[model samples]
Target: MKILITGGAGFIGSNFIHYWMKKYSQDEIVNLDKLTYAGNLSNLRIVENLPNYHFIKGDITDKKLLEKLFKKENFDLIVHFAAESHVDRSITDPDIFLKTNILGTHNLLCMALKNRTRFHHVSTDEVFGSLKKNDPAFNEKTPYDPRSPYSASKAASDHLVRAYFHTYELPITISNCSNNYGPFHFPEKLFPLFITNLLENKKIPLYGDGEAVRDWLYVEDHCRAIDTIIKKGKIGETYCIGGNSEKSNKEVTYKILALLDKNEKMIEFVKDRPGHDQRYAIDFSKIKNELGWEPSVSFEDGIKKTIDWFSTNKAWWKSIKNGKYKEYYDKQYANH
Candidate 1:
């Protein structure tokens, strides 16, 4: 199989590339990334020189580039992952999210339609909005109630994918996954940020009261779920993939502190971003039952593995944390 993986240099996407290369060595893969702030080619250093692996630095919004690549590669599958995913960034500037997540997805859908390639969309549980303490977890059937611009853009892209499937008879599948943490995670996200911050003996920022909850899926587990969906899932179907582990930001913070032998003194409580969802949980029973796939990594095990990765990968994260990222970090956390 020849596959086109968008944003393949980013965290989850890069992990998926590694997973695919290991499990399906016979398949050819092309990674297309915009090399944005979050995208890192260093994540794919191991596979960068592989015979079957290729990389293209490009934007998904470029119609001509997509056309040329589709014509040249004749890909069998397209995994769309390119997006401006940070809620804080999207809140400050929504134009990029809409352009990449919505319009970029539409452009890819047009290419998939023209080339007759199977498409799979990677999405987030945030699109279903927040859950109250007693509310049911988000499932494949949940209605989208996006509160942040990030989620709203992803929701629009999800709708576009479904519309192509229903209206144009496009072969497509979608998966809405929970928060993923593991190797290659950029330092800006919660887990990596906290882990790297503690490594440098810097205070880790905790938002609001640190009560916002997220279902933490290991990135490898997420990769396996996506593989299952693409291989065995029915076309036009959507699956919710989660680790089935729910942890509050506070709990996660203390866990990291404990793992690193640090105290709460290393934590800095900050003003929470607007539209911070109180909780997000996923009911992944559909994928479990239909594809016989479920998260294998428990939170206890996953967090340790993630910490170890960051511990051993100091040079990688260190390079990322310096320069422009330092500026963004200071600006974001300045007045808190």
Candidate 2:
């Protein structure tokens, strides 16, 4: 099979590419990435010269380019992972989020419809908004009440995917996953930020009271789940993928600190993000029962592997920290 994956240089995307290449030797992969501040080619150094893998530098918002590539490659499958994902960045500049997450998604949908290609969209459980302590976890049937520009844009894209399925008979499957942490994760996110800070003996910032909860999944497990869904998921259906590991932000930070031999004293309370969801959890029974998929790595094991990766690959992240990442941090968090 010839497959095309957008945002293949980003964290989860890169991991998925590696997973797929190892699992299917006969399959060919075309990786499309815009090489944004968060997207780094260094993540895919292992497969840079693989004959079955090809990398293309481009943006999903470029409709003409997308059309040309679809025609040229005749790819049978597409995994749409390209988007502006950080909530803080979205709060500061929502225009890019709208263009990338909403319009970029629509562009992919148009191409899929035109080519009648099978497409899978990677989404987040954040679109369900905050859950009450006793509230049921998010499922495929959950209503979307996105709280931030990031989630809102993803929600809009989700709607577009479903609309295409109904209007044009597009073969598309969507999966809404929870917090993912593993190797190659950009440092701007919670796990990497805390890990890097702990290494530097810096204070770990916890937004609000640090009670905000999320369901955390290892990126490799997520990649496997996506692979399962793409191969066997019923078209026009949405699935929720999660670790079933729920923890408050405070708890997660403390765990990471412990792993790094640090103390809870490093915690620093920061102003909460606007529209920050108080909690997020997912009911992933659908995928588990239907696709026979479950998370292979435990939270403790996954976090340790992630921490070790960040610790050993300092040069990879150090370059990003010193370059465009610093500017992005300054521009996005300047007000905070």
Best by TM-score: 1
lDDT of 2 by residue, 239-331 (tens): 999998999999999899989999989987878888888888999999999999999999989988999999999998788778878787666
Instruction: Kindly provide the TM-score of model 1 when superposed on the true structure, using C-alpha atoms.
Output: 0.99
Off by over 4 Å in 1: none
- RMSD of candidate 1 to the truth, in angstroms, is 0.6
Give RMSD to native, each candidate. 0.6, 1.2
C-alpha positional error of residue 14 in candidate 1 after TM-score superposition, expressed in Å: 0.4
> Candidate 2 lDDT (Cα, whole model)?
0.92
The pairs that clash in candidate 2 are none
lDDT of 1 by residue, 1-336 (tens): 999999999999999999999999999999999999999999999999999999999999999998898888889999988888899989888999999999999999999999879999999999999999889999999999999999999999999999999999899999999999999998999999999999999999999999999999999999999999999999999999999999999999999999999999998899999879999999999999989999999999999999999999999999999858888888888877
Q: TM-score of model 2 relative to the true fold?
A: 0.97
